[model samples]
Each structure stands twice: as C-alpha cells, then as structure tokens.
Target: SAGLYDEARRGWLYPMDVNPAGQNAFKKDAWNKYRIECIGSSIRTWLNGIPCTNLVDNLVSSGFIALQVHSIGKNDTPGKQIRWRNIRIQTSNVKPSKADNIFVVNMIPNDLSAQEKKEGFSLLWDGKTTNGWIGAYKDTFPAKGWNIANGELSVDKAAGGESTNGGDIVTVKEYGPFELKFDFKLTEGANSGVKYFVTLSEGNKGSAIGMEYQILDDLRHPDAKLGKDGNRTLGSLYDLIASKKIANSTRPIGEWNRGFIRVNKNNKIEYFLNGIKVTEFTRGTPEFNALVAASKYKDWKGFGMAPKGHILLQDHGDRVSFRSIKIKEL
Candidate 1:
C-alpha cells in the first residue's frame, strides 16, 4: 500500500500531493477509465489520462491483483458499495506509459528503476557490502558497531556516545553538486545523521566534521531541545537552519523514512524528509555565514564550503538502520 493511488484526490501518499482542481478533477456518477502500469519496480497510475502515481518499489516483486470494497463509516449506508466493469489485466507485452511530471517514490533498497538509471542515479551503498566506505579518520570500515544484513546497514546502540563505538563511516569517494537519497529507520529515542561535505580535515573530533541532516526522535531525544530554535531537530540542517514543520514531514519511530539532499552547482542545498522539502540554504552566503557564526561550529573556518567531500553515516551510538543509499551527480 506504499504507493497506492488515491483515486478521490488523484495522488499518492509518499509526499503530500497537490491537485489544483482538487476533487473537481474527478467525474462524479459516471464511469472513468483507470490505467495502471506495473513494470519491475515502477508503478504508475492514471485516471482518465491524468497521472496519479509514479512509484518505484521492490517490496512485493510479484502478487496477484484483487479488488475489494472499502469499509464504510457508521454514519454511511450499509449497502453502499463500489463496482467494477470491463475489468481487464494485461501480463504480456506490457510497457510503461509516457512519463509525467509527478515525483517518483523510490523505495527499493540499494536498487534503481530504469527511469532512475536513465536519470543518472547510482547506488551509493551496495546494501550488503562496505566496499566503498571506511571508518572516519581510518582506512577501513569499522570492525564493530555497524551491521549489514537483509539489505540494511545499521549502527548498534552504545551508551549514547557520539562516535565512541565504531565511530562514523564515510564514502571512499567524494561528490560535488549531487543529489543523495537514503532510507532510515530509527529506534525510540535514537539519534543519527546523514552528513554531506564531510572533509574529515578536522584532525580531532568525535564525529567527522560536516553539515548534517539531523536525525533524532524529536519527542524523546534531548538534543532536540538543546539546539537554538529547534535547529537540531530531526530533518533540520543540524545547528544551522530548522526544517520547516509541515504535513508528512516525518514518520513514526521504527518506520522507514526517506531522506533526500540535493546540492546545486551554485551552492544551494535542499533537505527533504519523507519526500517533503524541509530545509534549504545556500553555502558561502552572507546569511549562511552569519548563522554559522552563532552555532557551535563557529570556530571552524570555511565550514560546509567544501567543493567535494565524502558522505557520512554518523555513529551516534544508537540503533538506526539505513538503506537505499543512492546518489546522482548533478
């Protein structure tokens, strides 16, 4: 049900969908054509030629299709129902329809759909291997505190110490002006981060130095209350800009949440949580410099201005799982 199309509103649930015409876009008391395209990890839907959903997921590679009437509320009539006519299913010679402007909700961990490949995205983490990662300030992936299994890479909980266990792990290669996407699942009261522009130049540190996409159980984590003006809360640009409060901005603890970061060639950066853009800022700007001056990293000159650097998965000594790590160099 992750990508189930909302016929009434004509949208998906991943990010909040906007329908300009709203429900008026639907034809009432009449038959309408519905088309669904399910190929590999790509799933798209259309209602009378209007695109509804474009999703990429591998959770259910194969499954039989079934239709059912939704349960009604107590105030509704008991006999109220839904009907299907001219029902058809195509399994042969299936091809995807023309592309639309809707966003794709990619959920297959460590993999990409054909469209994503055509768009120049590649897997950053191979899901089960550490071939492209190494411990921060070290030459190899940490021997302990990080676990890889069942298509998930996770850090173990250890006394709530920052980088005290296995420390942080970073990408072997550096990236510039790229788009990064990852899926994370956090335990209750857990903390972690997906960092970018991590130069690792600061010789002395607990976690590697970088701008962070803060991850925390905002309700339970003390760090959520520690930063100025909620800038350290989940989805924030750690200690810099606060992620905007909005609908579907985050998922519940233990549920998978999508984290997206895009850095433009002009130094503009955007952060997203669960497909919703939350924080945006430009590096090396006067406003950005002033914000940094007021934060803990103020003493570090040239902070977050690296032209290219490794991506980091922080070892904040909490159980947090990561998957579907991918990047597209822009």
Candidate 2:
C-alpha cells in the first residue's frame, strides 16, 4: 500500500500519503507473480495470476518496473519500510516503424506536412538559414546577435547588449490568426519572452508594447515576483494573467523545451509547455477584461487587443536558443 500525504511536493513521484519519516512497508508473498503489461494505451496488472486492475492513461507509454521501500523521518526517529520480490514486466520489443519512401517522397523540406498544410500552416525558420527573420530595429538583420549552431538558432550573450545589438527578431510576414510551435532551451538564470501583436515605433521599445508569452525560470528568476502577485511567472501573460499550471516537466538546462502558442481569429490564446496545456484565455472576454482592468495593463487600450500582428522573439540578453520553429495559420 502507498502512503498518502495531504499535499505533494514538486518533482516527487510517490503518491501523497507515504510519510517522509514513517516506516511504510510492503511485502510480496513468495511464489506470487505480478505481471504488468501494456495493451495499447491501457496497463493491465495481474497479481498472483488474478487480474487486479487496468489503468488507461495517455501520459506515459512504458516504464521500468519498480519496487519502492518508503520510510518516514527526518534525521533520527524516521519510519521504516519493506521488501518486494517476484516482480516481472512484459514490454513491446518492436519499435515504431518509420514512414516509407513512398510516403516520404511527398514531404517538403522545412515545410509543413500535408496534414499541417491542410490546416494552413508554414515554417517560420527554414531549418538551414534565417531568411524570413530580421533584427527588430532598422531593416538590416543583426550579424552577431544570432547564430545557427548545429541546426538551432541560438542567441549569444557576449555578442550584444540587451536588445541593443541584436534587438528582437520578428517574422517578415505578419500573421493575424494562427498557431505557433517551437522548441526552446534556456541557460540557467537566463530571461527571455515571446511576444505577439507587436507594433514597432521609432521611440517605443520593450515587450510592453504588445502581449507577451513569458519565457523564464520560475524557480530562480526574480521577474517571477516582479508582477502583481505571481502573475508574472513563466508562461503567464507577463503581468495580466497567470498560467494555470507550471510544467516542471522540462528537460535540464541546455536541453530543449517544446512550446506551443495558439491564437485564434476570435482572439482565444492557449499556451502549452512540453505538450501539456498550462493556460488558456479568451481575448475580449469580460473575465479577461476584468483581469486587464485589475492588472498593470489597465490603461493600455490595445494591450492584448490587436486583431493581427507580428510574432516576436525577445532578446533579454541571456543565451536562449530556439529550433524547429514552425507555425500553422488557423
């Protein structure tokens, strides 16, 4: 049996109840067999040749068999644990097959697949070079602010000042209603953001001009506390909204984090981190209006009110890298 706790700590996999100091115990009878197998998306568990349960979940497809020994206690008088045996697992040995040449022949390089094409999507960064992107300021692209290293578009900190040398970059073509997907990796303590509905002027600078999809380290960044309450944390709308969930399910620093932003023609915005939707908001809604009214964006008329605008990558002066940047117009 698993111990239960009232609240679970971040990144811990055990169920809530297992006391940190109590001696939680589990024992398996001798000659008893526990078979766990995956049939499609369901996991079937049989204990002692008797079916116990079938769990259906899309979260994980497969994993290793584990027998846990839990004990509760801090330093001296903690709880104890147990032992488990006769454990076995059955797994599919066949790897998922790749598409054949016939199906691959129709695929375009650095372009949307047929399914995505049908949805009116396209590639923003043409895997090989930066053709449709330019520095945020002036007309010429920044020579040193960005680099294509090992297929990733990486920002070098020493190359320039925050938004001074490299500035922010935007798509050459403006989009009104669409969905965007990309992979990003951030250095520890680095700061950056993705902004949309961006309007550039001679004097105006910074992401305050439009709406921002904040990219930051929630656990370490000070900006996480700069906004009203905790609304300014990573994945929230900078200062106006809060992400429903923070996906700690990120790869370590320097590893890529998949992100998705969907803005519909009707002004609905959805944010996803690593394939898990963390937040959703409808623009122009009364509830959204209330949030804006109560937030730092109260005075701005077009705060998040644009019908269409350009997509921008923020240059917060830290080393942030992006790759597999693609988009689909919805």
Candidate 3:
C-alpha cells in the first residue's frame, strides 16, 4: 500500500491509500525490511527484525503480493532510483471478493456535481488555502503575487517580476491527459498566459520552455499586434497557430470569462471559450512541426512534446482573477 506522501515525495507508486502494519516502517531514501502475518481482521508486523505493535483496518480479505521500485531524489540528485526483491504471498483456499462502488471526492467545485462525482471527476481548487499548490520557485505560496479574495484567485500587479519574489504558481501534483475548466478575468491593456507541460530547472528562465495557452486582452495588448495577422490573439495558441473560431466572448475589463482546455490520450488538444470550440491541434503531427518551426520556439527540440507536466498560472503584471479551477483526468 503506497500513500500519497510516499508517491509525491519518494515516487514509488501513484497516490493511493495505505495502512501501515508496524511503527511506520517507511522512510525517504532509506529501506527497511518487514515481516508480517495476517489473520482474520488483523495483521501483525515486525519492522527491521523487531516486533512492533500497530493496528490497521483489515478491509482486504485476500490479495496478491507485489514488489515495487521507487525513485527518490532532490534537485541535486535528479535521477535517483530504488529497488525491491524477494516478494512472496501465502493464501488459503479462500477467494477474493469485490467491494461495492466507493466514491473518491475531489477538491474543486463544479456544476455537474452528482454526475461528475459518480464518474470520478474532481475539483482542483476549494477557494480557500493553497493546499495542493505552490509557487513555481519557492516552497510556499506567493505572498504579494496571488490572492484568493471573494472566491477568486487574483494576480497582484504590483508584485511583478520574472521569478523574482514569486514566479508562477503550479499544482503540487502533475497530470497526464485531462480536461481543465476555469474562469478568468483580465485587465484591459494587460498581457499574460496560462502554460502547461511546464518543467522546472535551474536552466530555462521564461515561459518559452513549454506550450502556453494564450491569455491576453487581444483587442488591446501589444503582443496581439505583433504576430502574423491575428495569430497571437486571445485563445490562439500564442504566436504559433491561430484559432479558427472567433467571437467577442471576452467580458469587459473587470468581468469574468469561462475557458476550457481538454487534452486526450492521443495528444489532441482543444480549446473552448464561452461554450465554443475555438482551436484544435494534434500534437506530434507534421502540421504541428511546421507550426513550431515558424514560431519563436524553433531552436528548442521537443518543446511541448512531454506527455505530462505542471499546470501554470502566469503573472504578467496584470490584475487577473481565476475561479472554479477543476480538472478530470482521462
């Protein structure tokens, strides 16, 4: 059984529930041998050749045994690895039974609560503390850069720089293919963008390392005037490709606008605004290659080619607000 902290920090397994039998035999970057015996609703464990006293919920009747290899390292040792062996299981003549449907709740809010929850959809933001989120540079939340006021996460303009005080704010967790929904409100004559496939390093400085979903007041910003025709407009994949559909769906200066981004397992990316599909791009295609070549990221190899990365909220020195940030992994 691998816990959430174990998966995030040590990287052995995916985030799941766990019940330890002994006095918490797991440690970061350190191994401990365990001997355990299971009976009816009880599992006795010995940690490192020492018998210990601990109790766990015996919800499992019978199951197969498994061994896991984990990766654990800090920024200094980026590619550390772990291993395990000598795994065996003892079973009686009893057969395993299936349990009933159990719902796993998410953190964010949504409209289709009943149906989404039944289908395993989750909310990413709870409109409160930034529990599952952190600044892209530092270990804690941004002090003067972002604020959750009046049920919305607003970007503070006065605290603006390139990763100086606080850079972008990303989810503490990462994702693969998923449908992300959020609402944003932008200031007039300001520029910003939301990016994905974001990998952090002591290397790259700006947003050009990953693919960015263009978020700007296209009608007023200077960047919207720089690209070919209107290629850099709002919802047009920044400066590379242009969105086909165009509607005046953006609310004025202080009003909120709904935005949705969906990425499938086949690497198909779709962008929607105000319930209209504005852009569709298939990654790793010849057309995508051509677009990347013509764009500013021509020199970079495999710029947006990662299957998974961090979700980033940008700070372009503008007053931007976001709410209802939720995602459903496919």
Candidate 4:
C-alpha cells in the first residue's frame, strides 16, 4: 500500500504490481517515515529515504488526502493493526525529490512525459480532436462509425466487415523511421490495426494498404486464426510475422494495453505489447520479403518497403478504443 494511487481513477498509477524496494522498506515493529512528492506532472515516493515509486500523470491536479485501513482478508488474523503519525502537507516551496533512472509510469492519456518530450515525442492524436487525422481516401475525419470521448478515440461496431463503416483513418503526414506508442482496448471479438507505411494508393476500396500491427481478440476474433501461424494475432506484424508469446505481455480483453511500434532508422521494425518486445524484422530483407511473398500482400509490389508513408488506424467495423497516440522521429 506504500505507492502512488490515483483515487479518482481507482487504480495504482505507480508500483503497479509490486515494488520490492518499497516492500523491504516496511517494518512491522518499528515506525517508518513515508514520503510523497508531487509536482506538476511528476510524482515520486520514498520510504526511509529509499526510493519507491516514480510516476508521471496529470489526472488529479488537486485533491484531499485521507487514511484507510483495509478489512481483514480471508487469511488474516482478526485484529492486525496499522498506524500513521507526523502526517504533514506542504503547498508552497515544496522541493520535489530528484528523479533517478527508475522507470516512470505515465498514466495520463494522450499526453507525454517530460522525458518523452525531451526525447522528441509529440502527440499524434490529441485525445480530443481529429485535427491530425483524416479518413482514408477522404479529405476529412469520417462523419460516421467513430467516437471520441473520455480521452479515447474508438471505432464503432458496424457489420464487422473491414472498412464498411467509418472506414480507416490515416495520419495526414507520413513517417518512416519513428517510434509510435499507443494504448488500445478491444471489445470481445474486435478486429482493428495500427498500420505504418500506408500509402493510401491501392484504390481505397478498403482499409488503407500498409504494414499492419494487428489488434485482435485472439480468443474471440476469427482473424486471429485466419492467417498462418498466428501472424494475424494481437501485436503481430500482421501476415508477415507472428507475435511471440511473452509472459504477461498482454492484458485481458476490455482492459487497456500499451502498443508500441518502432521503425528504426535502418528500416528494422519491432512490435511491443505491454512493454514486451514480441516481434522484429528488418524491411526489404530477404527473410522479410520471403514472408511477404507468401502472405496476402504478395501481389503488392514493394509492400512495406516504402521510404515513408502515412500511419493508419483501421476501422475493421469493430469497437476498439485507442489513446495516448504519440510518436518520436528517430
């Protein structure tokens, strides 16, 4: 319980599962000082001068603090005890603890942390506007089958056929060597994708042509089994390579999961699910070309080899929510 918790969001924004340092900082028979430093978007915590949590979020700017004692658990003794003392609060001239190399958990959707900003990252989707996005093969954001609310941009379910509803949306600008980060939540049986190298040149009859980072419900979506060797499954390089199984690399359906696609300056592409690298391949290589040549895109010359192209979000006619769409050019 010695961590950063966002009461407004009803979730722990830092030390998500376990913080070994924080756990070791606790003492059963001795009193220990608990410290928290929150400044703007940066939040840090410590116990007995040992760093516990480092986080960046903007959800709650101001709020009151309260104490709580948990109810006894099934295995607990009837009256296990806890206490607090010397509780203090400061508003002005509060010096934030210096940040270390510890990873920072960023929970604010559609926003970037100071580190991300310093690393050249910028919002691709502003979380509330479609200014930088346009419907595939169209001049504006689609008027149907898409919803923007509560800091999420989502596609509405319709016929469950690819591009039959709001169709696909693509970034107005193109990118080649870049790193993209997004958070996505899938409905049961949903199918969608984050595509790169999309040229929007294949006649626009369906989702824009691109190298897809597949987003699907592996247990409920048929497409998860349609492609060879799970290539169409979640976090895959869609048809070209399968997303390898990584321990706890995927969140449960209906929960948000981080999706990352890194297109290195050398044309090597990587896909990460929940911060775990699951797939990687270099474009235009013999191995990559051989995979493409045997997949659905075999007929498309120079598929996924474009020097630069627009980033796309597929509207496969299923509900899928996305946020925190940010990117950094390499």
Candidate 5:
C-alpha cells in the first residue's frame, strides 16, 4: 500500500509499481542532495544522509545515467515544480573508511556477486532481455501480454485466467540438479507459479506440465483452498506436498519475496520461502509416485520423473514481476 502509484512517493518496491512522489526522507518543501555510487560490482543509493538502496549487480558495467522529472497532471497544482542542484561527478575511487550508520536496503537485481561466481552461480534471467526464455507452447516469446523493463520481466494484467493470453514461458535449456533463486512481486489477487522440470514435449492444451512452486495470494486467491491440505498455497509443491508455513516468512502482497528451489545429485528436492526451507522430498520414489498418483497430475504420463527439463514461469493473467533470477548447477 505504501508504494501504490502516487508518483513514486511511496518509494519503489520493484521496477513496475513505485509510488515515488509523496513519501520522502527529506523535507517536503525543501532542498536535498542525493548520491548514487557504483563501486566495482556493488551499487548504493543515498537519500539525504540515509542509505536507501544497496546491492551487487553486474548487468550494468557502464552506461549513461539520466534524471527524470514527473509530468504535472491535470488534477495537480499549476505552479509546482521539481528541481535538482549541485550536480556533481566523481571518477576517482573513494575508499570507505567506515560503514554507514543507517539502514541499507539490499536490492540485488539480475546480478551475480563475486561470491556467486566463485560458487559457480550464473544469472538465468539477463535482466534486460528475454534471451533464455520462450513461450512454453510456442517457439518464440509471446508478442503481447508480457513486458521487460527496468530489469524486471513482468506479465501484464488481463482477463484473469491461466495460460489463456500471453501463455506460460519456459527456459530454452534443460537443467538437472541445480539451485535456482528469484525475487518475485505480485499484484493483489494474483496467481502465478515458478515451475521446474518442465518437459516441453507435453502437447497439452494448456501449460506444459511440471512440478510448480505455487505463487498465489493465499488470503485472496481461491486456489489456495482447492488443493489437498495446503499444498496449493504459496511456497508449496503445488497440489502434492504442502510447504511448512513459517511465521514472518512470506512478505505481504506487493512487496518483493524471495524463492529458492534446489535439486541435488541425490535427486533430493527442496523449496524455500525467503531463506527458510519449507519443503523437501526425493524424486522417483515410491512415495513420490504415490503422491503424484493421488494428485491432479495423475493423468500426466511420467510426471516428475524426468531427469531434466526446462524451468517455466506461468502467466496467470495477473501482474507479476521477477528479478535476480540466478541458478547454479549442483
């Protein structure tokens, strides 16, 4: 609610919906200075004297920077103006002698940190283009209904339905035994999913079948109650195994949330909400077969038994954005 499209006053939550107009750390009718710095692979932002946004991203090594002024609206004051002063540039290295004494927000978008590179992790989503993904059913990306802007891959809102318009999208390459991480932000009453082991061979009438890490508005979506127990809820193995819901784990709607899925050499699969492990299971087990047998995927041939498959992002006809999509082969 804080960042809900009021000229960005609420502070940007993600790339798509930011209320950057009204809320500010500076005086409303006063002057302030801002400093944006990029050091090696790290980026940090400051408002007044407070640390606002900080993270490590590698997509932007060098580029032109631009400042923007919001347009005056029809319902606004005529004489109101936005101004900036003391424009400065520093090319010399400034070694920090000490740490800042304020909260630094970490918004690492579409980047691989040095530690991640050492750990053999790479970005799955390049943050600027749809290079590694394609429409789940089609050979190309959807012509409409999906958007890529400001380092976010977002599905635009449409007639609410599953795979009806832009359809689902999937990775071009298949993966086996990997650790995947992404940050997702959802609009109100949205329903989407991050799917793994997606065998594109399925010629079904709808989405290519795969095991999904369910994303939903548990408080607002009806699908939350349709699956067995709470398996269809957020962070759950959709309709098969329920994620153990933890207190203070999932952020509320409209705020960014972190998701993790790991499949190991031993064929062990684990899911996480934020950084907490919420579900775990082994693949191709008798118990796994029995669970799939009782679930909605009972009719799909060889469900969840494939050795490797593409990852997918479901378009549930609601606005949802994803960023910092990175993965590491285990």
Candidate 6:
C-alpha cells in the first residue's frame, strides 16, 4: 500500500467505493455512516446518508469487499486510526430515498451519463482505444512512440523537440463548430499542445499547423520566455495571441487539469483551463489574420484558413497525457 494522496489527487478511487474516499463532507473526526446500495445496474452510495456517488455498471456484478489502509511513512503519526460501525446490510431490495440537495459525483470513467447523452454529447476518444486517431503526417495510427493505458492517451518522453521524434497525432474526423473537453496532466517542463482546425496538407515535417491551445509549464519551459509577450504560454493560441491575464484555476503538477475548447459556427474560439476562460479569438477576422501574419506560421499557405480540420494532440517529445477526451458537435 502506498500513499493515497498521490492517487486521490489524480481522481483514483478506493477499491470498495465508486468515488474517492476521505472526502469528509461530514464533520472531520465525527462519526459518519456510509450507505452503499445496489439495484440492478445502478449502484448508489452515500456519506452520512447524503448521496455522493451514483454509478451504473454491470461488469462488476459481484465482488469481495475489503477495507484498505494505505501504507504510511515512518514519520507519520504512529497510531493513525480509522473507525467504522453499524456494518449491516439488507438484501431485501431496499434503498435510501435520494436527496435533492447533495451533489452526486459519477465516478465511472468515459461512460456518458443519461443527462449527458440527452444533451447531445458523445465520447470522442472512448477512453480505452485509439480508434479515432492517426498520425498527423500519416494515414494510420503511429506504430510506436505513444501509449494508451488505463484510460489515458499519452506521448512518450524523448529529446525535447517539436514533433521531431514521436510526431503528432490527429483525429481521423474533422470538426467545424464544436465543443471539446478533456483532462490533461503535465510533467515538469513538459511542452505539448492540443490543436484544432488542423490540415495535414500543411507540411510533411514539424507539428501540424493549427490554432493551438498551448499546454505548457510556463514558468519552467523556455518557450514561455521566447514567445512574444507570453503568447506561447499555456492556454494561449500558440505564438500568435497571448492568453489574457485572467484568474486561472490550474491543478499542481502530476494532477489533472480540465481543458475546454469551444468553437462556434462564427469561428469564435475560446480556450478554458479548469473552467476558467483564459483565451479567446475569432478566426478569419482582420485582427486574427494580422496576428497570424506576424507569427511563425505566416509562411504556410492558407494557415488558419481551413474551414474544417481535425483535432490534433501534439507529440513534442515530452511526456504529457490526455484523458476523458470528448467533443460535442455544435
């Protein structure tokens, strides 16, 4: 058993629970009851009778239940304790009534919820397969240099170079007006990006040309210092428009950060990090074309002119991972 904090910060769950443990919505150090109920495909859980997890899964129709206490370090409090009582069950097909106030966190990965599906959302990556991706410079998925495991798609670490080693990957399908959401994690000084409106016709070398949502450790990466006025910092439209100096809520390194990129039919593009709007620019506008004219991509014919293009995951030869990749067509 290792420390739980490291895994919990990355949204890992305990063996017996649908959601992460130690949430402590109830008063700390106070006695709290955890109620777990299963009704066919639906498994609901409560902390102190306050609903917390609502999961629908049939794969785990049965299993053993066990209590886990992660191993602690030598400097830890010697007598760290956990207490539980009233460990009883009713197999008579009964469940506690749902409370309307408490939020129910769905911990199941990549599966669309009823509400999400009704709202016209679909899983873009499906969390476990590379069925929708291909190398930006090639027609098939790369034979090597990328990894898909445990529901995460990641680029392997190599010599720090832009699309030089592993190359870049793109969605097989193109997008026009869409809303994309995903979770990303960064290694120290890692430089990667999520790009859209990508046309493989750009060139045979280097990263694909697109409007990039820069993913970076701005303070640690040298690119943060080289770009014009932080234009290449995280959340910016890489190398062209600087992300606004707004309040951004980013998790620490090794933890997951949510990314949101929305493009309306009008080409109003927005980039958000952890639900905070960090950058926005309308493509095809005079100001946009002007900025592109001065940026590094000016030489590429028809840059940012593609009406519809694929979404790309940059392989900058640095370790970066993406998960929960999803998109909603607008």
- Taking all chains together, each candidate's TM-score versus the true structure is 0.81, 0.64, 0.63, 0.75, 0.70, 0.69
Backbone steric clashes in candidate 5, count: 10
Against the hidden true structure, what lDDT does model 5 obtain? 0.77
lDDT of 1 by residue, 1-330 (tens): 223643443233454332222223457677777777889877877777777667886656787777867667889876665677998899999887866665556766677877677778889999879989999999999999999999999999998899999999999999989989899999999999999898888986699899999999999999999879999999999999988988545778888888889899999998887766789999999999999999999999899998999999999999999999989998
User: Which runs of model 5 end up more than 4 angstroms from their true locations?
Assistant: 1-106
Please list all clashing residue pairs in model 4, or write none if there are none.
none
**Who is ahead in lDDT, 1 or 2?**
1
Q: Candidate 3, residues 1-330: lDDT per residue as tens digits? A: 222121232221112211223235555676767666655543444556544422222335677654555444456566556566566666676432222122222223333344345555566777777878887756787776778877788777754344443467888787889888777888877666777777664256644256777778877777888877677777778777776644344556676666778889999998766434678899899999998999888877787888788888887777788887878888
Query: Candidate 5, clashing residue pairs?
Result: 7-20, 7-21, 8-19, 8-20, 8-21, 9-19, 9-20, 9-21, 9-22, 10-19
lDDT by residue (tens digit), candidate 6, 54-166: 54445457666667687889899788798867789777867645433321223356666564565566788978878988898797888877999998899999998888876
Worst lDDT 10-window in candidate 6:
11-20
Deviation in angstroms for 141 in model 6?
0.9
| lDDT accuracy of residue 314 in candidate 3 | 81
Per-residue alpha-carbon lDDT of candidate 2 for residues 1-330, written as tens digits (9 for 90 to 100): 232111233231222121212122333443445555555543433444444332333445655545555555578564444445655543558342221111010112244544445545567897778788877755766777777877778777753245754778887777777778777888887778888877664245644266787887767767887877677776778788877664354556766676778897778888766545667899889998998888766877656777777788877777898876778776
* Model 5 quality (TM-score): 0.70
TM-score-superior candidate, 1 or 6: 1
Clashing pairs in 6: none
Query: Model 5, 1-330: lDDT tens per residue?
Result: 111111333233222111132135456677876777777656655667555444454545787766667666789967777787889988787653244432122347776655567667788999998899999878899998899999899999988788888999999999988989889998899999999889887789766799999998999988999979999999999999998987766787898887888899898998877655788999789999999999989998899978889999999988999998888887
When 5 and 6 are scored with lDDT, the better candidate is 5
Q: Order the candidate numbers by TM-score, best to worst.
A: 1, 4, 5, 6, 2, 3
In model 3, where do residues sit more than 4 Å from their true spots?
A: 1-112, 159-165
lDDT per model vs. reference: 0.83, 0.63, 0.64, 0.83, 0.77, 0.75
Which candidate comes out best when scored by TM-score? 1
RMSD of 6: 8.8
